[model samples]
Target: MAYTAEAPAIAAGDDPMVPRIGRVRRRVRELSDVWTLTVEMEDGRPLAFAPGQFNMLTAFGVGEAAISISGDRDRADSGLIHTIRAVGPVSGALTRLGPGDVIGVRGPFGVGWPVDAAKGSDVVIVAGGLGLAPLRPLIYAVLASRKDYGRFALLFGARTPADILFRREIEQWRRRLDVEIQVTVDTSGEDWYGNVGVVTALVPQASFDPQNTIAYVCGPEVMMRFGAAALRDAGVPDTAMYLSMERNMKCGVGLCGHCQLGTAFVCRDGPVFRNDVLRPLMAVKEL
Candidate 1:
């Protein structure tokens, strides 16, 4: 028999890693029904992050919440922006915070969108309701590296027109020739004139090369599932579509069981996963 040699297994420690640790320097930058927080680096450094990645936020006495980074990916000096909706105890406390207030921040955690994978391909981004927060980072990433990809489209749907975040940013994207942006409401207010339908309905109007396009979706569970289905129906391959998952995250690291969704951990394995990898888990109600 001819001698054959096997390659040595690569060591995980040798891989280039994003620093897993972070610090607490709470400074509230903007607030509304949704609080836009900026956590300054204790050492006065900038945090590098991809779109769709999130952080574990801690209030003094209240518990922690997993929030996505909503700031500009290109602006490293800007720190991190967390657009938090006041839905619980910790979040309510966060809403009351303002400039110079102290809060603890850990991680720019979770798996982010596949920006590197989408490079050189057409991109279709779908976001519903609060999903915009996670999707915002990706939008900024794409725009900053605009020449790396082909045509881009963003389709967002909200419960009411008033619930939409990033209104000013959306207007700016719409004005750009490289991107196409659309907004829809499930139930329109009297002032809405553009479109009134589910976010999936708007997907059909966007141009994409099924073979060369990559799709991303973030929203409520139902919306993620349905929006992914819509993309599949529109000829996008199952492997090319990705969805962001939501779960209760306690420890930002994998030690906590709060974010386990079956065999996958939303906090560790993914906050963003390919459609085929997520299909089975997203269909289960208890997970």
Candidate 2:
């Protein structure tokens, strides 16, 4: 249950239930079932959003699904970009859309990564599989102001070489001398030559002061749990760790308790939470 982007239900003047019209400017196939859509609003206003924020995209007759905004944070004026996997009716419909097609757009809802709090401190990002899409904005933010922080590291894991997302873009990022990028796979085929293991295995290889570092993590629940544990073992404090939690969120707002985790609503209160608030909830069984 990863809600990559969980922003507010509605902005001023926009109804929460009513979705605005948007036209797909471009669509790129990232994987066999995943597509990245670059959309622009019908009225020409860009969808202003923060890092790790999410939006509910509607597929007209099909339905709507909450997807993370996966565009460069520095280019907010380019409307919206969402990376979606065709796993369901709504999402499949989204992936089928092509250039000039119309789609429905909703809130860029919820609180985002505390990137500002991380300024002046070392920053590390841990992501797995599709989890990287939501965290990409944060990476852009970090790279946009690389001088503000120290020792930037990105540790990512995918199921296989073909399963890796944003491969070319990630390789471009790897070219930066200031960033320490480590990518791993669950299984490396004969065509591939890279580390083969879980992403946490690369955490220790990152060069950052545990006491002075801030960590942002997103992935499958099991992966996030282990990643947090690995970071904790490396001496990073609980307060310095943040995670994006996912749930079956129907409404982008807090009205629906479908996304309730304990007493907090993932759509309103957070899709992102500090480890201090998340640790206890994650440790309990059936929570």
Candidate 3:
């Protein structure tokens, strides 16, 4: 189920094709089919990664999947975390793992969010459903250095209230006076009483200096496409907006062309890319 690409696909003096053994430290259920697993490498080294970067995780006998390191960047020195939804064969296997189980781990791969570039500027982050997983670390990094940036806003949406990931953590964040966090669901139950719309609907209402703003967005391809347009209509330029396009990433490295998007490789050039660089490629139908 794997193929070779190039011998130098992996740098940092490690083999690109080999995976290190990782033991699950803990597992928490986030939703009906979603779980967050905390893991530590058998070698005891941390899977320290930049915000928005991802890893290739193996469920041993099943398969491997590319997942973002969904942990607080400030605490990643302790271990790695990945919040995965049981949507596919590999992911289903990943979710079935529990504490004390061993799995295969590779990477901390690809470019990360431009946290440094946002210094002294307003930051608007938008996520839909599980997209929040990859952005969690960026939120932690930004707040840990709150004074380094200007206005901050987060807008999230899910299919239903029950499908909202990190519900409690997000509620805690909404309490912070300095950061603006809003959550909306597509459908509401009898007990639901919050906004019932897409996350992009909150973009135009967000408070930020469009001329000095940097935005990060992640979600379904359709969601991200509309989300980018919403940010642009709200006055943010394409250059200042970034998107995470994590699709068809077979190899964490570029050796496998499975993640190719136009001339760029989602596993190499991105998973994160500026709107200006991605819009054209994304516009091509069925690309």
Candidate 4:
């Protein structure tokens, strides 16, 4: 039977409709285009969230963007971390803010990765570009409870060596003997010394037992399709793999149909979905 995990509901004290005031605790320029912001709730409570869920960040006058929560879930006292690419007005504004600035936030909403279901299985994580941001928390969770799983592999692909999101952390993760890290870039300069190709190429080299592996993939739609195809060819069933999807989400609740993909709302039903549930919708380009 296919494994279709139900999306968990928002916890008590987390009202997606009510925007909370949060202060920017810190900001780090991750890349020329990407920035990581740490925010603390005005009330000093932690912004609790599961891995793969996102928050809608309001830039006061500019508007809002749905950004995935990228920090460690177990350390809520450290504040919520959002890694954002400044590609628009709102994101640009949010990125420009410094510490002590205030912003409107709603969420920690939507579905999350199936970490519990993946216990005892080999884990394969494939990420491309900024997609790594959303998947970072999952990696943290897996590493924190490393003994519960079998082999682990993380294959990341970026536009260039400079485009990699978490370079220092990737290096630290690489030092762990139990975790496998493979990095590749689409283009490279002389300083680069890594694989060069699409992320799917690294998929073939991952050391996971195909039948007993659970794969998590995030990236461009095209990249995800190819990654899913690669995982399928390697013997992973559709039900054992998942992907993250993004859409125009006006409201975090189900009332806004802006993020509807077929019957599923990217903001409500998922941002994370089992491959079997998303494959059909992905085929229709207009969705």
Over 4 Å off, model 3 = 1-11, 284-287
Q: Each model's C-alpha lDDT?
A: 0.77, 0.88, 0.87, 0.89
Candidate 4 lDDT over 37-120, as tens digits, reads 999999887777888989899999899889999999889799889999999999999999889999998987788898888899
Q: Write the per-residue lDDT of candidate 3 for residues 1-287, one digit (tens) a residue.
A: 11111112333777767898999999999999999999988988676678888889999999999999889876866788999999999999999999999999888778878778899999999999899999998999999999999999999999999999999998899889999988899999999999998889999888999999999999998999999999989889999998999778788778988887877778888888889988776666544
TM-score of 4: 0.95
Model 4 alpha-carbon miss at residue 167, Å? 0.2
Cα-based TM-score, every candidate: 0.87, 0.95, 0.94, 0.95
lDDT tens digits, residues 1-287, model 2? 33234333355898877899999999999987789999999978777788888988999999988899999867968768899989989999999999999999988887788777889999999999999999999999989999999899999999999999999999999998999999999999998888899999999889999999999999998999999999999999988999988988788788978887876778787788888888766565544
Model 2 off-target regions past 4 Å? Answer: 1-10, 283-287
Clashes of each: 0, 11, 0, 0
User: Among these predicted structures, which one has the highest lDDT?
Assistant: 4
Off by over 4 Å in 4: 1-15, 284-287
**lDDT tens digits by residue: candidate 1, 13-129:** 422222322343454433256767777766565666767778777776786778888888778586668888898899888767766666666666667887878899999999998
Residue 13 of model 2, lDDT score: 90
